[model samples]
Target: MLDAVLLILREVLEAALILSLLLALSQKLHLQFRWSLIAVTIGTIGSWLLAHYAYEIADAMDGTGQELLNAALYSVVILSVIALGLFICPLAFKSHLENNLTQKKIFASPSGKKLIYRLCIVIVSFSLAREASEIWIYLSAFTHDTEMLSSALIGSAIGAGIGMSLGASTYYAFTFMQKSYFIPVFLAIITLLAGGLSMQIAKQLMQIGWLDSATPLWDSTFLVDEHSWVGELLYALIGYDSRPAPIQGIFYLLTITPVVSACAWHAWQLRVKTHE
Candidate 1:
């Protein structure tokens, strides 16, 4: 039962937080979130497909197929996130880009709006598919154990409720924040999430011996027990790990550096223009 609760909570919170952020972003932009329905439907189907083929996939590519596929999928997500970040960066720091009419038109144009919506849909669908398939696979294992299955179902429900509540609270908090802080805060959250995901990709590659493993830089379990509720929340929110390898940090930095560099460059450009 405890296992069920933790697993469900982790997956639910991860997806819920991401979806909530996307919805909040849409609302902030004065755009409709109707596309979420389509994303959910597609994601549901994807979850079933991925779960159904789990064994076959694991058996392929010299038993490294699962790792390879996960790495590929994660790469897609990270790239999509970077693209989204680039798109939003100008708007977030518009005080600097205000004189650049092209940047302004990018937000106002219908094509730009479509691109944003499409990116959000892609992120949500992939995230949901990846997360929900794990739950499906786990729950499917207890089909023969009626008693255990019942307990698991109850635990899952409780976990889901808690996760949804937390996610909603996060969304409301974003909504309540002053407009000046919203975009920057959103960017920071996404950056942390993306970096954490890149760390996961590093782990996945290392599992297949594609990426060399390194000793953990430090143990943080004393500060935040990875198995505890707070740990779980942080894991879902920022991909927190109690013992993180140096290689993982490298992967994280590599993934986030582009976005950070671009933002810095934009800020410098803005400073120069201001001085002019």
Candidate 2:
């Protein structure tokens, strides 16, 4: 039951974090909540449909279909997050861009602003869809055991409460930060999430023998089982892994390094231009 609680909490929190961040950004731009609410409704319906077809989906591609579907989701999530960062990063530090031609932030033009708003809807939709699918699958596993089902229901309620509280906390925290700090911090979080998704996609691929998942770099299962409450929370927040494969670790680091370095370089260049 503890395992179920932690797992559900992690999945719920993942979506919540994405929605909370997007909601905070939208509030700043005066974007209507209707669009976001519509997205929430659509995602909930879509995920339920997908969950209903889970057995057929899992049976596809010689029983590797589930992994493939997960990989595809990671791809969607990866793209949406990166695009969201591109749109938000500039607006967060508009003063940093100097030239009139280049100074037009994503939200400067009507079309561009609409594009950002739409992407916000998409990112939220995809994030929720991904998490909802997992939660549905996880809960469905306890249908046979009445005791487990009762325990799971209790666990889920508590898990959801914790997850939502964390997401809300993150939103409020961002609201209190200075713009200079906010942009970089926001970008960093987005980048980290993207990298984590990439690693997860790789893990899914490995399940089908498409990529090497030969050995763990180091085992931390002794320290904290990922099924534990704290470990599961860390997994959602920062991509923690107890028995990370070398391939996953390598690619995860590779995925994050370039984005972080590039963003840092651009911020530095902006600082230099400001001085000049």
Candidate 3:
């Protein structure tokens, strides 16, 4: 039960943290939660359906189907975060959509609203599906074992309760900070999270022989092993891999470089507008 609770808590908090950040964003954008609600519903159904076909999924892609699917989900999350962060940044706005190519053209135009709405849907649904599927897979594994049926059910319930409680606490904490006017800081954290998730995708790709990674650059396991509880929490939250492969580092930098450049470009455009 303890193991179950910890496992569920870790995964739930990961997905919940993303949701909390998005919820804070809805307030900033004056958007309704209707789409988010829909996302959750769809995500719940989708995860259950996927869980139903767990065997095929696990065996697909040369036994790396799950990794591939997770990579795709993480990609969606990373892209959505980047899109959402553009809106979160106060200076991101379009100026006639003709003045400059480097200007913030995403959330500042007519189609921007629709884009944001689509992004919100993906953000919520994909996040929920990614985390929920893992829990379902774990819990489902024991269903066929008659002796472990009772234990599995009880553990799942207890785990879910603890996970939800912790998730709620995390949401409230982020909300408090957002209300206190720390939105930029929050966006920065999200940028890192997105980059980290992208790195995880790179790792998954390598796992399936799609990406070639040379070797480990260095090992920090002695300092912070990735198997430890704190390591797992950090992994879920920020993609903190202690013994990161060289490709992971390269990919993480590659992902963040453009995002940072875009932020800089937007800042420059904002300055140019102010001067004019």
Candidate 4:
């Protein structure tokens, strides 16, 4: 139950942060508020539909078929996490689209409204795609048990609601707080979370034989089993695994360290540029 709650919190927070950033960008650009809200609504609905389909597919498999399905789901989770970590990090730091949108004065025209609506639709589709991909991966992990499924679904819904509210509040707070200071801090938190998730994905892939080399770099399984509260907390926050394979360890270091360093450097450059 605690694990389920933690999962929901992390995933929901990630989605909320992404949506909030996009919404904030829209506001900065002086985009039509109604159209933006409509886009978000469409995106949320589309994500829920995709998650439902994933759950249905998982429910229909059994025995060896179930094993195969789980493997596939794990693969999807790893791939999606990698893709999102790569794509979102750069965008968070160096999004020029928002700046371009802000510069446009034609939004006051009738054709501009039409263009904005079309743009909003595209944004909605893209956002939904990202969210759906993540949600599907998450659902795939625990779709086997009836009780777990129920808990995950209910917890995810509640978490998403709370996260969205928190995100909105944070955005409003930052409006008065100085975006120059807030942006890096926000990006740092996200980078850490993504880095941790990436490590977990690498570990999962190695465990399921989807990846090569299954030797543990250091067997810490003796210290607080992952089911324990301390272990679970570490796992949720920092991707802590007691018995991680060598390849998993290598992948974690290779993938997360470089990406996080690059992100930090990029954010620094952006800050310098903003000041200049």
Top of the candidates by TM-score: 1
Stretches off by above 4 angstroms in model 4 are: 1-7, 21-46, 55-161, 213-245, 253-276
Model 1 residue 219 lDDT? Answer: 95
lDDT of each: 0.86, 0.77, 0.74, 0.56
* Model 4, span 90-173: residue lDDT tens: 445755565334335345466754654554454444444444556667867777888888888887777666666767886676
Error of 4 at 17 (Å): 3.2
Which candidate would rank higher by TM-score, 2 or 3?
A: 2
1 versus 2: better TM-score goes to: 1
lDDT of 1 by residue, 1-276 (tens): 888989999999998998888888787767788978888898889988989999998999999988888787778778888888888776666664363454558767889989988988888888888889899999999999999999999999988888889889988988888645777788888888899899999899999998888889899999999889899989999999898889999989998888788788888887887789
Per-residue lDDT for 1-276 in model 3, tens only?
666767777777777777767766665555676777888897888778778887898899789988898898888888888877765554343343432342244445857767767888898788888778878888877778866766766766776676667667766776666332545566677888887898899899988888987778888898888878778778867889887888898878877776677778877877798899
Q: Best candidate, lDDT-wise? A: 1
In model 1, pairs of residues that clash are: none
TM-score of each: 0.94, 0.87, 0.83, 0.49
Ranking by lDDT: 1, 2, 3, 4
Candidate 2 C-alpha lDDT tens digits along 124-166? 7877877897788888998999899989988998888889999
Q: 178 in model 4: Cα distance from truth in Å?
A: 1.8
- Using lDDT as the yardstick, the better of models 1 and 4 is 1
